[model samples]
Target: MSQTLQAIYAAKRKARRFAVQGIYEWQMSHNPVHEIEARTRADNAMHKTDLGYYHELLSEVISNADVLDALLVPVLDREISALDGVELATLRLGAYELKEHAEIPYRVVLDEAIELAKHFGGADSHKYINGVLDRLAQSLRAAEKQQAK
Candidate 1:
């Protein structure tokens, strides 16, 4: 990638990493969203992250978590309660991006979510994340999927 594109990609990856952590904290502690964002920004190297996207993912995903969960629950093999915190947070972020971020390709969303699961969740959790998000993408990005074919 060109330097500018590379920078943007790195920043977005960093944003996803931090957002996943923030979402996990939100899920486990039920902390306020702004507080989580502030704490994450304070504790992390924010210079390299896509701060705006991080805020969007953290704030929007948490705010719409119930709806995201409702969409995800049907695709899951087990109950939402049975999922690990990391997997759940990653799924929520992925679901939000798939449903709301039309500018981002569905494949990119799935790949990022899989990466999050691999880095933060159990060894096999990426597979489950992949399965759920893949199904979600088919529904949410139906036209994009059709175009790709």
Candidate 2:
């Protein structure tokens, strides 16, 4: 990957981490994204460079979340709404890439989510996340092909 792309992914990983924390907060209080964004920003416990990336990513994902979740439901036979906070948000982040940021190869997006799932989500969550993302990537590619024709 180019340095810029690597920087972007670094931003995305940070975003994923922030997204996890924000999602957890949303679940707890059902707060709006704007409020959560402000809160996450208000603290910034450290003067860290990495936190900025995560903060921006979390903001984007949270802001676009309704549309993102809409894309997820059809792929899942069960109501994904009932999924754990981390799993649901992780899927949203991957879906955001698949649906909105098609510039990134679908496989790479899925890979990022799988890596996150393995590290952060529960046992077997990686497998579950992988399955959903694989299907999502295929759909995204198919849609792109159709749009091209």
Candidate 3:
């Protein structure tokens, strides 16, 4: 890939990392999305972060949390409420991307979510996340997946 594309992808990955923490915080504390965004910007160095993607991921996931959780219900082995906060946050982020961002390939969403879980969730949580998001993609991106195959 070209250097510019490489930069964009890196920035997006950083955005995902930040969004996971922000979403986890929002889930735990019920903080307003704007407050969480402001606090995240103030507290962290977002030099190369994709600010637009970060804001979208954080806000959309919080605003449509119920909808996102509903999408997760069937694929999740346990209750959504029973999931570890980080894992839940990561799944919601991945689900949002899978359902809303059709331009983003499903495999990319799954991979990113798994990476986030590995970094933020308990040991072996990445495997669980991979399974859940893989199932979600099957339904959410069935057409795209079919084309890819």
**Residue lDDT tens for model 2, 1-149:** 89987776676666666667786677667898778877877876533336665665566677777887787877875787688777887898888778867786777788888888887899999888988887776677786646555
lDDT of 3 at 128: 97
Candidate 2 global Cα RMSD: 3.8
Which 10 successive residues of model 3 have the least lDDT summed? 140-149
Q: What's model 3's lDDT at 44?
A: 95
Off by over 4 Å in 3: none
lDDT by residue (1-149, candidate 1, tens digit) is: 79999999899999999999999999999999999998888887799889999999999999999999999987889999999999999999999999999999999999999999999999999999999999888888999989989
Instruction: Kindly report the root-mean-square deviation of model 3 from the true structure over all alpha carbons.
Output: 0.8
For candidate 2, the TM-score is 0.75
Clashing pairs in 1: none
Structure candidate 3, residue pairs in collision: none
Candidate 2 weakest ten by summed lDDT = 44-53
Off by over 4 Å in 1: none
lDDT of each: 0.93, 0.75, 0.94
Return the TM-score for each candidate structure. 0.97, 0.75, 0.97
Superposition error at 135 for model 2 (Å): 0.8
